[model samples]
Target chain A: MDLSAINPTLLLASLMVAATPLLLAAIGELVVERAGVLNLGVEGMMITGAICGFAIAVNTGSPILGLVAAALGGAVLSLLFAALTQYALANQVASGLALTLFGLGLSALIGQGYQGIKPPSFPKADIPLLSDIPFLGGVLFRHDFVVYLAIALTAVVWWVLKYSRIGLVLRAVGENHDAAHALGYKVVRIRVAAICFGGACAGLGGAYISLIRVPQWTEGMTAGIGWIALALVVFASWKPWRAMLGAYLFGGITVLQLNLQAAGVAIPVEYLAMSPYLITIIVLVIMSADKSRAPAALGRSFHASQ
Target chain B: MKLSKLLATAAVALGMATGAMAEDKTKVGFVFVGPIGDGGWTYEHNKGRLAVEQEFGDKVETVFVESVPEGPDAERVMTQMALEGADLIFTTSFGYMDPTINVAAKFPNVKFEHATGYKRADNVSTYSARFYEGRAIQGHIAGKMTKSNIVGYIGSYPIPEVIRGINSAFSHARKANPDVQFKIVWAYTWFDPAKEAEAAKVLIEQGADIILQHTDSTAPQAAAQEAGNVYTFGQASDMAEYGPKPRISSIIDDWAPYYIARTRAVMDGTWTSTDTWDGIGPGMVGIGEISSEVPADVKAEALALKDAIAKGEYHPFTGPLNKQDGSAWLAAGETADDGTLLGMNFYVEGIEGTIPQ
Candidate 1:
């Protein structure tokens, strides 16, 4: 094994890109859960976004427009969930599962002609001076614009959830929907908005994977990353910063394990292959040691005068 | 919900589906684990299916379902095909081993051919190409082309098939350049593009100048292109689209000849269960074009190795090789037996890391 082969700067730098998708999805989910709605369709929304973003990027020759289209696509799909759960009063869990299935099938159908077609490359934003600094420059400044946006979104989510008046109302709505409704809050409207935001964020995550990560269009390209985002929300105990921490932790382990293998570390292949998931499980068990602290009405559908 | 009622309903559904499709032709079916547009392993298999259609224009009817998962879902798809009067079926992918046997048991009158699987029954015949033959040529090129003497290998899994390819490539690479080193990264997935690309990036970061992948994705080729100066070979299909650079050569799997012959055997009522393992000599494994980007000397050497292998004048795993712990595995001039190679689980000499239990 080549111990000297592992470069800390490259490791930390790549992990930032690796963590962006999960962080985007988790931060959005944190907001949705805080506003008293539980959506299990994150996987579906992500895959749909993957195709929508891919199609737009390939057609328009603009990754920026593609990313915007991805968010809109995700929001549109989430509105369908909103219609089913809010208007039809269907079981939120069942509707969410259906959404995921529908999204996977829908994305595959949309991605039929786009398979194997590469999207135009999005250039990295290597900030001047800062990016030239030895180790920290590579770690912090030499990344695509999305990396900075992911971190900024995390900080904004954490701050708004903990400090703002809107944050207080969201937390109140999650704590007890009946009381929030009696307190003159339009619980359904706020929950729908939160769900749409969550969908858009999840879409952005899926789009990041298709447009930048793999940078190609293929059926089921998102794989099971949406499920991981869902698991991260629970692992974070409904906190935004903790979700970022979880994303980076998993991302760091993934990049580190790959480096270890490339360095010819003598660890058995099976263990190294599973190291990322194993570490995540250990951290998740520790987090679950405390009381869940989930939103009181997290997965409950709100109905007035029930 | 009674068994009899279920059977009756299934029979009626099957009759409705096939009655409209049945014609005076041999019914052939294929099951693929990936989309036909995968541009790699499944793409080659689908090409074989297309060849079958071409071989028997008006006398054969071809049908296939893509992206069949390698478990119970595969069993269901196969059983459905049998019920729909598919007289012959080909299930591709190693994970379909047991499922093929299971589906064959109930469809004894119908013939089944499974690729890269070992198990066989009365109605099931197992067939796989000797892919290591191609890996040997790839190794020679990798060895000669490396400026850094380090070749990164992206392994899909630790199964015998993948492990065998690693040993074959490493042995030949080391033969050409004694100082050469191979670093293996097992992605444990067959078709996840993002994961495969990340693996390639990690290997590139670690000083790998020539990347070889057993995983079925164009991601590594893309990663190698972006990194520039890195060389790669396509795994299963000729990914010539990368052209002239990263993908300098490839191992093209040609299943058409065997598929057509097997279908002919079925049409003639001579089909039976058997194990078929053919290589470059028998035209199952094809060496793709050695791009001009590769140095002339390296390309000629690689082609020489390919010709020797195809003519059966040489074996990729020849003698004087030791196990990972330096134990004597093969004496000088002693060729490995088919049994040992089929179940190969250990690394050859000078290779690092375990096969992963």
Candidate 2:
């Protein structure tokens, strides 16, 4: 492969753009999982956000407001799953699946009239002097505000998880809900809050696509980005900074394959197109092989009676 | 008892008459594989549906269900439309071909129109466009205008409709300049702006100065404008506003004529089941106003080719073509037939990549 054909600056910029959605979603999922909840319906929440964001943005003519609406939309949808899994004690897996189905159908119905219309563009925030630094400036400093916000969120999440008392309680809940409940941590409430956070992040990611990435509403607009975010959470071993790294790595692969095809590299376009997903799977398998790194309570359901 | 018997007879006769009259309204329904707002394929088809409605007023009543994924769900949707008294149905997209055929079997009385597909039944007719014709024009313009020999193409799927477009564009590009190389990226999606923009940026970074897309959405145009110096053609709509900088021309899908004509045929009771593939010649494929950004001579060349193609004097897929392996695919003075083109699975000689399995 001819690596010289790859433009590092453009690749970095595109990687940021592509990774924003995943980073937003993975960080959300990481929080949810850390609070002893597993929501597989991140895809559904993201798509709902995509449609809601597009609809609001088109009507209001403000992309920022649209993203906020998207986050709220996603959180609202996640509340349904929270109610079922947390209150009714329904199967987490089934409720998550239902959430996805419901989100997809609801988004389609609401998005029907909003098709073929373009939403307002997001403003790019250029970092003063850094934006003028030849190659690095264009790649890192010349992105929309959401890109920087997502990175900043990763730092904040990492800091909170590492130092804060509430973070310790959330981690304690994940480690053993029964013990946390006995210690007066309000296990159900904490989990519900985490679920809402995950939904909002997924919504923001979805909104980014509809508001900034594609800036239009189309059916299935999320297009498996949610699933990729879920996988990123696993690849990151449920850590926030690692989630950021995994998202960019996946984004880089995606951008790189397209670049290779454009540079006339002698690889089948289909293989290159599928490389991102395949690489994600490989990374996940490798991560899983190091069994000690995985969260002990991952995918396990906790009950008050137990 | 005598009064009750007479009332029952009158009601039976009235029901029969109402059933017959309901069948005469020419209810045309549409089954879309994707949402109509995709601003590309389904959007254009929905526009055609609106045109049919406008042209045939009371003679036809149209209804549509969007985002019907192509599979059993398609079968269910078609069946429902048929049950709801759709006299004529248009199933758009190739993936609907089999389901259309399946539904056609169950509703032998209903007339079915399948778009961009070849499957036909006693009640089913197929319709498509020679979109490759328009792509030829785009190729001519791109070839003439590009400062860099590299051109980017965002393709939706490996289906024949998209493949034919790639081949047509490449043929014209090669004709304009032997050194012109195409960078084709398969997004494997019909309409996702994020993916499409990503594809365009990749091409731009690799030195492509012009872009073409078989995918839906205005992302490629937006990307071209953002990159500067990169030119693009509108895929399904006149996306000129999105590209004040790089949009040179657009292939507008004018489905009004076909929609109106088909409805008229149904109204006249002369709607026979047959495949119709119309292009710029018959006004089905519309070439939007060429932007002033293109060089005067390049615009002239593009128009000349368009006129020739419209007049049937030029064939985009004509002669001297070879498969990707350098084997003789078509001899000089030979043209590809509908059957071969419909099943086009291999790349042309100049295309360096293999089709993904």
Number of the top-ranking candidate, with TM-score as the measure: 1
lDDT per residue (tens digit) for residues B1-357 in model 2? 999999999999998886677666888899986667666777788899998878778778898997787789999999999998888899987889999999999999889999999888889999988898999999888888888898888888788788889888988988888899887778877766788888988888888899899887777776677667888888877765654457889898887788778878877889889989988899888887888888788888999999999999988888889988999988998988988988888888887566665
* lDDT for position A267 in model 2: 79
Best by DockQ: 1
- Clashing pairs in model 1, backbone N/Cα/C closer than 3 A: none
Off by over 4 Å in 2: A1-3, A36-41, A47-70, A76-145, A158-163, A171-183, A215-220, A231-242, A290-306, B1-28, B55-63, B70-88, B102-111, B259-272, B320-334, B346-349
Error of 2 at A290 (Å): 4.3
Quote the TM-score that chain A achieves in each candidate.
Answer: 0.96, 0.94
List model 1 lDDT by residue over A1-306, tens digit each: 687898899889989888998888888878988887888999899989888999999999999899999999999999999999987889989999999989988998898878657788887999999999989998999988988888999998888888998888888999999999999998888888899999999999999988887777767767678888989998789988778888998888888998998887888867877888888868876977877688988888779968
- Candidate 2: what's its TM-score on chain B? 0.90
lDDT of 2: 0.84
Model 1 scores a C-alpha lDDT of 0.88
For the predicted complex of model 1, DockQ is 0.53
